[model samples]
Target: MAQYSGFKQLLIYAVSMFIIALSFYQWDMSQRKQEERIHETQELRKQPLRETCAGDKETFKHRLEDVRNNELANLIVDDKHGIIYCYIPKVACTNWKRVMFSLTKDEPYPDPASISPDLVHLPNILPFLNSFPRSEIKAKLKHYTKFLYVRDPFVRLFSAYRNKFQEHNEYFYQRYGRHILRLYANQPDPPQSLKEANASGMRVSFQNFIQYLLDPLTERNEPFDPHWRQMQRLCLPCLIKYDFVGHQETLQQDASQLLKILMLQDNIQFPPSYENMTTPAFLLDWFSAVPLEDRRKLYELYEQDFRMFGYKRPRELLDG
Candidate 1:
């Protein structure tokens, strides 16, 4: 009886161990399948961009002439990674700059998120491609993994407006807002209103902001701020064969794929995004404030951007 009882106990213990082993095997297989799917999706996202670069050598060279001054100055070079990123403002540029800083520093930071946005844009922190000789710049452009992120033109404009005008950005209010008021508010001494605006913490209205943008003199005197500048002009996508073209809309997935392509997944990850400003409701709320005539003009101004990036005009803006 004692022997029979011991056999039964041993059999039960053996069966439990076997079941546990089978469960682990299934989990491991599932994990492998999930990783494979992610890899496949990443490749699918990059396939078209890779194809776009295959036959465009002459066209890229022809478009390089238009890349003078600021456009050239904007490229942040990572020689170690052979990467050149054109930082377009209001398109998660601050975070991108932080990532670049991490990639190129003599001793890379383990956490890019810890770097302040202020520190990222310090003039000497990262070297610009333009700082290099023209020959060297050309070589990097040809062979480097060039990438830029673009947002919808109108959405980007709204973001700029919010960041610069709607928020308590003293520099922008003093520099651009004062000028905007002087030009559009029809007030010679708009300081009182400006003072009130500051004290009251009021946002610059979309209509008034539109007036500032549409004024021809604004561009004649100075180039549009990079925040609202057309992405085509800023990044010169036509001239540069970007190995990756990420969008602000699909930033996480696109950035993850980009990191995988660069083989930086183990070393660094794209910082967690804090804001998603491109939601349909958020867009509708802002566009509702913009008048029809102004909206049409804004669209006309950015028509090239729309075509270049293959973004359709938002139906809400048109219908509103």
Candidate 2:
């Protein structure tokens, strides 16, 4: 829920959000309407156009006010509805995908790995999403509701480094253009640009990126400073909060609310056992390999996230 002050403020905020959602949602609807109007106008343009079976009295009628009257005629982009599962590395993002896209044909739902060349940036997450030619995205905006699963940056980055890089083939690194896979426990500085990382084969997995941030001595043989201290010190919670800002700790509740808003309950089922995971909790691994100083840094970076979503960081536990 949005933070609001007076009744008037709440009303204004609610209206604004509604209007924003409506404006974008109505794009596909408006585009379809425009197309129909254009065709109708064209027919009128040729006032004395060719005579059909009955010339304007062809025994055909359309009820413009009702969708039931028009929808069956293929007048809507209903199936074109979509949801963006911008999968941030790790966190409990996997659980979200399972609840949202699992059990509906084809494995690996909400694959962030699916980030294609065309959909590289957020602006291009969907066609016509960059503001112009807004019809496609606009028309289907209502039909589509976007969903993103984010995690604490450090935790997420660490996991991404493991599963995406250490566990799998060096494909993502290749996507960013890193020739060599990477070594165990090796963390290097975050790359400046894809070009820079690709140029030096530093396009490692997100986890590897985490390692780089934690271990300053990475590839110590070379002078590796990525310029921006923030970039070099990027944390998971910070990365997630930068976007639409959802809660990983409250993932089920948040996701369920989203599903209810989108009216996708029938198609998607909120799982009773979302807690099921292939691996143990992250704190265990952090205590073993991650040093106290680095863990402290992670806690500090993600402290706000913990407080906002009501989660106790493992800092105290690790301390003792």
Candidate 3:
């Protein structure tokens, strides 16, 4: 009886030890896999910027002109973290700015999403790199882990249109919609006056917007709105050595890597994207409304952006 009892005790002890060992092995593998994921994502984010600098030297030279101008104004500076972000409208600029606010200020918000979008853009809430003297701006640009996010040009254009035109955004419709209507509407002089235009509820069509964009004279009279402007022109990616370049396509992964690189993951999270806003189907539907010639012209207008960012011409916009 004593021998039987001893054998039973030994078996139980052996099984417990085996279970513990298995748990440790599983944990170690999990940790390693997570580390590998982070490393891969980091590499994916950095590859394009590396390729751009090496392969596109002449284009970089042309973009270098922006460095002479007060391009620092485009950047939102987080001096504490030694980070700088160039805010590009419609490319998650609001959330990026919101993250900046949380990073810079002590006022606690549980996460970036808790902050209102309107409040994020309020001047003086965040410090800008351009606010500093020219010499200081040069120093920060050289040392900071500067970054920016960009999206597909046509997709971004569509997002801007939907947000500004499709919705009941009176501000854009009044300011830009009327101007576009006056210029591109088939019926010449649709509204006799600005008040009449507003009262008539004149909205800029996607086609009208594209026509306005293709007109060289339009940009000469009034510069491109930052919303639809080329990211290359807006961010001056060539002039500045961005430590990380993120794409809006892989936003969650890229943003996760960014927070990890900055070591801020524990404190704040990037805002969730509006998936319904810029899907592949949404882009195809909108582009279908635009004629092929106009589509090609639109591509030509943003060709530098296409080549710089390594984005292929979206097949939806290509001639069949």
Candidate 4:
């Protein structure tokens, strides 16, 4: 009876071991399949961007030399990690700047939130790709992982208007606000100062801002401001190949994936993005004041950006 019991115990141990091994194999296969799915998703995003750049002959020069310095200035370079990020204004850039700041530090990087948002934007706090020599720039472009985040064109424009005009921003007021108010707001003699403007309740309306963009003279004189500039122009996606193309719509997922790709996922974290009040749903209401012809013209201006970044054309706004 004792001998029979010992044999039964051995058989049970063997069965348990087999089950454990099978579970490990199944888990590993699942992980691999998940990774494959991720790779396919990334390819879907990148392939179209490449095709768009290749197809557009007028806008895409396909050469870095044709790109000007101010344009390249948007690219923030991190030599230590070999990462280059092209930051667009109003696309969670403040938080992204903080992440870049943390990566620049030594091992056990500081929490991104701990860094001052304003300090990162201050000149010389972080190195820009444009600041490097021509040879260095070329080398970094070839070897480093390049990425940029984009947003819905119309939504970005509205956000820019709300932040610069509706808010009390002294510099924007002096630079673009005053001009927009004078020309579009029908305020020929708008307040000279932001404080004065706020006190008198004089601000540029959304329609006025759109009119400024559609105006022939706006581009004839100078390029659009960086805050309101098209993502294509700011990042030079055609000339510089970006490894990862993130959108504001999927900021967190894209950011997390990018950090993992860089092998910094373990060392750092992307800050939580605040809720964006401006969204596609709000586009119709905001554009209600804008004329149909002007809306079409605005779309035409940013058509390259929409196509390049894979954002669906705003048919709702344009159709009307």
Task: Please give the CA lDDT of all the candidate structures.
Answer: 0.78, 0.42, 0.80, 0.87
Q: Considering lDDT, which of the candidate structures 2 and 4 is the better prediction for this target?
A: 4
* Arranged by TM-score, best first: 4, 3, 1, 2
Worst 10 residues of 3 by lDDT: 61-70
lDDT per residue for candidate 1 within 210-289, as digits (tens), equals 88889888889998888888776787765677767788888888788788778888788889896674687887877787
Cα RMSD, model 3: 3.8
1 against 2, candidate with superior lDDT: 1
Estimate candidate 1's RMSD in Å: 5.2
TM-score of 4: 0.93
Q: Which stretches of candidate 3 lie over 4 Å from their true place?
A: 1-36, 61-66, 107-110, 190-201
After superposing candidate 2 on the true structure, give the runs of residues whose Cα lies further than 4 Å from its correct spot. Answer: 1-87, 91-125, 131-147, 152-155, 172-210, 215-254, 267-282, 307-309, 317-320
Candidate 4: count the clashes.
0
> What ranking of all candidate models by lDDT puts the best one first?
4, 3, 1, 2
Please count the clashing residue pairs in each candidate, in the order shown: 0, 14, 0, 0
Q: List the residue pairs that clash in candidate 1.
A: none
Q: Which prediction has the highest lDDT against the true structure?
A: 4
lDDT of 2 by residue, 43-128 (tens): 44222212221243322222222212211211112233355343443444344444433433344333333323233323322332
Scored against the true structure, residue 230 in model 2 reaches a CA lDDT of 20
